[model samples]
Target: MPPRDPSALVAEMSRAEKLSLVRGTADPAERATGYLPGIERLDVPPLRLVDGPLGVRAEGERATAFPATLATAAAFDPALAREQGAAMGREAVAHDQHVLLAPGVNVVRVPHCGRNFEYLSEDPVLSGTVGAALVDGIQSEDVIATVKHYVANNQETSRTQVSAAVDERALREVYLPPFRAAVAAGVGSVMTAYNRVNGTYMSDHADLVGGVLKDEWGFDGYVVSDWYGLATTVGAATAGLDLEMPGVPAPGAEDHEGEWPDGIPDAGHAGLFGDPLAAAIDDGRVPSERLDEMARRVLGQMARIGLLDGRERTGELDSQRHRDLAERVAGRGTVLLENDGVLPLADDADVALLGPHVHEAKLGGGGSSETTPFHSVAPDEGLRARADGTVTTARGVPPVPSRSLFDRLPYLDWGRDDEESDRPEPSLDDAVDAAADADVAVVLVRDATTEAEDRDSLALPGRQDELVRAVAAANDRTVVVLRTGGPVETPWRDDVAAVVEQWYPGQADGDALAAVCYGDRDPGGRLPVTFAPADTYPASDARQFPGVDGTAHYDEGVFVGYRHFDAAGLDPTYPFGHGHSYADFAYGGVTADGTDRVTVPVENTSDRPGREVVQAYVEPPTVEGVDRPDRVFAGASPVELAAGERREVTVSLDDLAVRRYDPDGGWTVDAGTYGIAVGRSARDDRASVAVDR
Candidate 1:
C-alpha cells in the first residue's frame, strides 16, 4: 500500500485532535520529552522524541556512547559520521524512540561556547557535509533525524533571552548552510533555538522559519521548538513553528536560576499549544488552515519515518559490535597535535600514567548529550592491556566540580558523577615522583565543561596545569593527553614532548588512547576548530563574548575560526586541520578541472601506515567594493594509505563552497581567477593551482 497522505489525515482530525497533535500531553511525565498524542480514532501514534547527538540519552538506559560530534568532525570523513549516526539511530530504535533530537550543525563561532562539542565545526562546509550525512543515516533507519538549534545559536550564556545579532550575508554564508544541507538531506525535523535571531524570537521568526527555510529552501518537514522554547501561540503558529516541544516542562523542572515556580506542573494547559491555541483559532487570531498545516507537517514526518506503517523496535542497543564501532570511530578522531619522537611508545618502556582522569572516564560533556554507557575503559586499564612493561599510575589532581546547575539534577546526571570508592586519590607530589621513576611520563589532563555556561577561560580549570608543568619538569619525555570537549590554551605546549587531543573519546576512551600511543593505530584525527591563545580569538573582547545587555553582535562577520587568523595574519597555537601521524604524507601536486573540481596526489613517505586529510582552500580574487576572507575552505578529502601507497583524490567545490553570498543577488558564483591551495592544514600550503571560473 502507498504511504498515507498527511492532508487526508489532517482533514479528518477535529479541532481538539488537531490541537493535541500540535502540543504534547498536559502531563509532562506521562509524555515523552518531545511528544504529541495521535487521534485514537485515526490510528495516529504519538511521536516520541529523545536527545542523541552522541548516543540515545534516555535516562537510566545503558547505550553505546559514541565520540563527540567534533571528534568525528576531525576525521573529516562523512562516511564515518554516517555510520556513527546509524549506530545511534539503531540504539534509538532499540529504546523505542521515534525522533532523535540531534546532529547539532550550529557553527562553532567561538571556542568558549558551552555546547561546541555537540556541534560539527567552525566552517559551514564541513558542518553541512557532516550534518547531512548523519541525517541521511538516521532517516535510513526509519527514524526522524532533527537537525537542531536553528540559526545563530552559537553561545549558551543567556541562550533563552539573548539576541544573536547576525547580518544577512553572514547568515546565508556562514550560519544557515548546515541547516540548509540538513533539509536537503531529507531530515524529518528542524529544531528552533532558545535565543532570538536579530530582534525576533526564532520560534516565531517569520523571515527565517517561513520565508527562508520553508519558502526558499523548500523544506517539507515540521519545525519543532526547543524544550520550553516556545514564547508565543499565534505568532509562532503563524510563523511556521509546527510543534511546541515538551509543551509543558517536566515536573520539578526549575528555571535557569534554580527556582521552581508554584503551580508550574499544571501550567501547560494555559500555554501556547493547548487551550490558548484553540482559543486563538476560535477568535480568528490564527487561521484554521494554519492549524491544519501544522498537523499535516507532523503527520507527514511520522509517515516518512514509517511510524504510520508499524515499524517496530528490533535493532540491537548495547552489544559488543556497537562498542567496537565506537572504538573505531574514537580512534579515527584522536588528534596527535604535537610529537617529538616520544609518541608510539615502545611496549617494553616503563610508563607512568599520572592524572585525576587516569581512572575516571569523562566520556562526554554534561546535559542532553550525556549517555550511560554499558561500560567505560579507563586509561590505566587500557594501557595495562597493551603495554608489556610496568605501568605505574598517580592522580595528579582532584576531579573538577560540576558547575552547571543541571548537572546536579537527577535526569541530567546520567550516572557520570558516581565515584569508584576503591581507588585511592594520589597527590601532585606522588605524580612527580612517579614521573621521575618511570622511563616516560604520560599525563592525562581533562577540562570538565558542561552545558548552560560558557567556560570562564580557556586555561585548564584546576591544579592540572601546575601538575602538568611539574611532571614535565620531573621527566623531559613527558606526554600530555588532553581529554576535552574542545580547544584549550596550552602554556606548556613547547615544554611537553607530545600532546594528544582526545576530545571526549566516549566509552572507548581508554582503549583508543592506548592504541594511538602504542602504535597499534595511527592518530588520524585533525583539528576541526582552531587552537589559539585565549586573547587571539575574534570574540575576545567583553562586549562581543557572552554579550552585554542580552545581545551578541557578530562583529567579525564571516571571519570565524581559521579565517580570522588568516585575515589578521596572526598565528594560532595550532592551525585548523593540524594533526600528526606516525608516517608522513607528501603532496605531489594540485590540478584544477577548470570547473568546480580539483585533484591532488598524496603519498605516504614513511614506512608506517597513515591517514591524510587533503584540504583545499580557495583564495578569492580581489573585488573592488566587496570584502572577503584571506582564504576559505572549499572542500576536502580524507585518504588512508599503507606504507608507500599513493592515491589521487578529487575534491568538488560545490556552489556552497565556491560561491559568495550576496545580500541582494543571493548565492552568486562570480567569474574570477581562483587560487586553490592544497595542504595538510589551513596554514600549511604544500601546493597551489590557479583556475578561472
Candidate 2:
C-alpha cells in the first residue's frame, strides 16, 4: 500500500506511538547515528539519521569520504556543491538511512573555531548560497536534508552552556541569513544548537525558534535538538523543538562513549522527553496539541520519502562515480595561494615529500563529521604513483598533539587510548637533508582540530613553522601545502616557492595534490576566509569569543571576515577569494543592473586553460548614523575558459547586498549610488560600475 495521509495516521495512533516518533533511541541494527523504532501495526519502517557533511558516515561501516565542507565552499560553485550533496544522499540511502545530519550552515564567525572545516564560510552570502544548493540536492533523492546549529555556534569552547549574546540587528543580518536560505530552499529538518542564544537556550528559544523560524519565516519543517541539548520537556516543545535526539541514554554509560549514565542526567537531570514528558502532559504542563504536531511532522516526512510505503529505496557505496567526484572536488577546491612559476612541476622532477602527513591521509577534522573510508591515499603514495622521477619521503616533525574537549581535565582523556599518540619523534635533520638534495620539496602540514576544542591561535600548531622555515632555507624551491581546518599564519610565505591551501581533502587527498602539482588539473579553489594574524580577527578577545562569564558578546556586530578587514582598514595576509590560476583572465565591459545583478566579459588571455571564480561585490549607499562594510559579497559564479576564450558572466545579487537591517525600521534600503565591482578576489577588483538605488 502507498503511504497514508500523515494527519489520518496521527489520528489512528495512541499517545505512546506519537511519543516514539518524536524521540531518538538506539538502533537495533547498530548502523545509524540516531534511530526511532517504527510501529509494526502502522507499517512505518525504522527512521534512521546518519552523520555526514564530508560524506555518509555510517557507524562501523565504510563509505566514500569526500573533502571537507570548507573545501567545497572554496570552489565558489553551488552546482558542484549540489552534485556532492546528491552523491551523499544516494550513499545515505545505500546505507539504509532516512535522514542525513549534514550541511552544517553555521557561519565561520570565529576563525579559530575547531569545526571551521565543517562549515561553509564567514560571509553569510557565500554560506547561504552554497548551503541552500546543498540542501536542495540532498532532498532531491528523497532523503531528508538537515541544516544545523540554528543560531551562533561559531566556537566550540563552552558550547553546551555558553550564551551567544548577539543583538537583533546582527542576528538578522549576519547569523540568520544561512538558516533562512536553507528554509527557503525547503530543507526538511532544522537542528538546534547546543548553546544558548541571547538569554535563552536554542532548543528552548521561543522568540527565534517559534517566532522567527516557525512564525515569521513560515518554516514548516520539524526542529530537532542537538544530542543531549534539550533543556526542559515543556519549555523546549512549547518553544517549537519537536524531537529529542538520543532521548534516553544507554543502560551503562561508561561502556559507551559520551552516553549519559543510566538514571543519570546530562548537566543536571536525566533525559527530559521520555517519562518526564509523559508526566508533564498528564499535569497539563505541556499541551497535547504540541505533541500531536510533532507526530504529524515526523509521519509527514516518512510519507513524503516513501518510508511508510511497502517499497525499496537504495543507493550504492564506494561507487566509482563517487570516487571520481571526490577527486574532482578535492582538485578543484585546492587553492594556490602563491606561485612564482614554481608550480606545475616538471613531470619527471625529483620530489621530496616532507611532513607528518606524508604517510597518513589528512581525512578531516575530528568529531561527528569524521568518516572511515575503505581506502585513503597518503601524500607520498600519491606522488610516488604519479611521478616518473624518484619520490623521497621524510618526517620533518612528529604529528602535533591532537586536542580534545577533555584536555583541560587532569583525569579524563578522550580517544587517547584509541589512537597511538606516543610514537617516536621523527628526525627533522633528515627532512632538511632531503630538501637540499631534491629538485622540489613539497612540505605538507596540518592543524590538529576537533569538535570538542577550539584552537588558541591561528599559527600552525607545534614546530611545523620551524620545520617549514628550515626546509625553505635548505631549498629555495620549497612548496608548502596546508591541510588545515581553517586559515593559518604563514610567516615563511615569502621565502617559499609556492603555497597551496588544501583544507582537509579526504580519501582523494594524495591524488588531488599530485594532479595539481603535475598540471594534470588547475588549482581552482579560492579562500573562503581571510588569512591574517591571530590577534586581528573580529572575535579576538576572550570577552567577545569564549566569553568571560557565560556569554559570548558579538561586539563586532555585522563586521565579519572581509567586511571587518575593509571596515577596520587592516591588511590580511591573503584576502578572501584570493587564489592564483595557471592562466590569467582579463575583465572588460563590467555592467550593473542597478543593485539586482552584475555582468562582465572575461577572456582567458594566458596560453593555458583555467577556471575563474568571478565575484561580484556591492558597495552600499552611504547613510548618516549607519555603519556598513565598504563592499559586501553579493554573489559569485565559476567559469571554465579555454585558452583565448572570451565569454560574458552574470552574477545575481543576494538581497543582503542592497539592504541593511535596522533596529527600528527593520530591513531598509539606502537611496544613493551603489558601486559594483567585478573581480577575482575581495581586494583585486578588475572592473567597476555604479548604479542608483
For candidate 1, lDDT tens digit of each residue in 121-210?
A: 999999999999999988888889999999899988777778988889999989999999999999999999878988898999989999
Q: lDDT for each of the candidates?
A: 0.85, 0.88
TM-score of each: 0.96, 0.96
Candidate 1 clash pair list = none
Q: Candidate 1's error at 244, in angstroms?
A: 0.6
Candidate 1: residue 125 Cα off by (Å): 0.6
Model 2 residue 296 lDDT score: 88
TM-score of 2: 0.96
